[model samples]
Target: MVLVQTKIVFHVDELNKWPEVLSNVTNVLMDLAQHDDHHIQMVVVANGDGIMGYLIPSINDQISELAKTVEFHACHNSMVSHGLNSARIPSGVHIVPVGVIDLASLQDNGYRYLKP
Candidate 1:
């Protein structure tokens, strides 16, 4: 059996430009998915206004499809602080307890870190 391992951590804190950041991150993620690196995951730690901005979806449909190959994780701490629940997260979003955890686990597994 082959084990696919590669992770990306996105620590998003800024509120204003987060939307654009998320969109670009989505693009890179899609690119990774389509590339030889088939196993790619995205851990998005959104705090403060970052939560609102991180929800943007990728533009290209192929990117959206490729996104399925990537795991999208949201920081639960932000959600709670923002008074948001799993229901509040847009479609295709996964909620994690915190970015710290996302880093410890996913990063330990060879996931790269991205600020956007």
Candidate 2:
């Protein structure tokens, strides 16, 4: 059986309200993945100061749950600039070479972009 999928890449470039961002995005993604016909694939590319959101202690469990649906990525370049090392970032968040280029490639490959 063939399945249709909705792909998404959420790019976060600022260190805005981390909790709200994840909460809102998770709500929207869960709603999108509700129907059997819609197979939602999502990844959040966090760069700049936004990468710190994934390390919040209050949302550790939420991040764990989010990982089940959303793949979280951190920008290594941003990490260096922000003085953050891999040892400090959460385990589940994958560290990519560059977040902007990754975001661009995802868009080029047809993943819808949301920077919220």
Candidate 3:
């Protein structure tokens, strides 16, 4: 059997523009779902002020549903600083210790790195 992996890391921590980041994130996820043929693993490393941007209902829903087909995660550090509980972020967004590490490890294992 063949194992296929599509790894995506949403690095929203480095941006100052929340709306633009949200827009781009949603679009990238949508494109990934529509274009990919193998298994997808999506990890969102939301840090800094961008945490609030991902709390949008529409974006959350899109990502939540996509989680059924893709692995989803958010940085616990960001959740703490933003005063957001796991319940507040999207339903399928898993909490991770470090987003950068997660992304790096996945890439090192052969998952592609994409930033939109």
Candidate 4:
């Protein structure tokens, strides 16, 4: 038997409102992973002010549960550039070496990209 999984990467570069992010991520989780056992692999890569979304409790709390299963990556270089630190990045998010590089590599690896 062949096992196939869907790989998706969502890139959040700007500080988007929580509604859009929550809706898209929830849709991916609810529509893809929860509804169908299609083996969904998802990631959220955030850079710039976009990282703020992960810091705020109102936003972070909403998705904290999903973080247990979903991959949430923050950009180390972006944090440095923005004068922010990883300590403020919330509990479940990880720090990638660089956000843009991470995005490029994911795309190269055949992950579909979404900007919401």
Q: Scored by CA lDDT, what does every candidate get?
A: 0.64, 0.81, 0.65, 0.81
**Which TM-score value belongs to model 2?**
0.86
Cα displacement (Å) at residue 35, model 4: 4.4
Which portions of model 4 show Cα errors greater than 4 Å? 1-4, 33-37
Tens digits of per-residue lDDT, candidate 3, 1-116, equal 46565566656764455345456556766776676555556555566666675677766665666566556667777778779887787766667877678778777876667654
> Residues 1-114, candidate 4, lDDT per residue (tens digit)?
455688888888787655586678888777764445377788888888887777677878876878877888999988887778878888778899989999999999988998
CA error at residue 96 for candidate 2, angstroms = 0.4
Sliding window of 10 residues with minimal summed lDDT for model 2 = 52-61
Q: Comparing 3 and 4 by lDDT, which wins?
A: 4
Clashes in each model (backbone N, CA, C under 3 Å)?
Answer: 1, 0, 0, 0
lDDT, model 2:
0.81
**TM-score of predicted structure 3:** 0.64
| Per-model TM values vs. the true structure | 0.64, 0.86, 0.64, 0.86
Task: Single out the weakest 10-residue window by summed lDDT for candidate 4.
Answer: 28-37
Q: Which one wins by lDDT: 2 or 3? A: 2
Stretches off by above 4 angstroms in model 3 are: 1-8, 14-44
For residues 33-100, could you state the per-residue lDDT of candidate 1 as single tens digits? 57673665665666666775544543224224534555556678887887888776766767777757
lDDT of 1: 0.64
RMSD each, Å? 4.4, 2.0, 4.0, 2.0
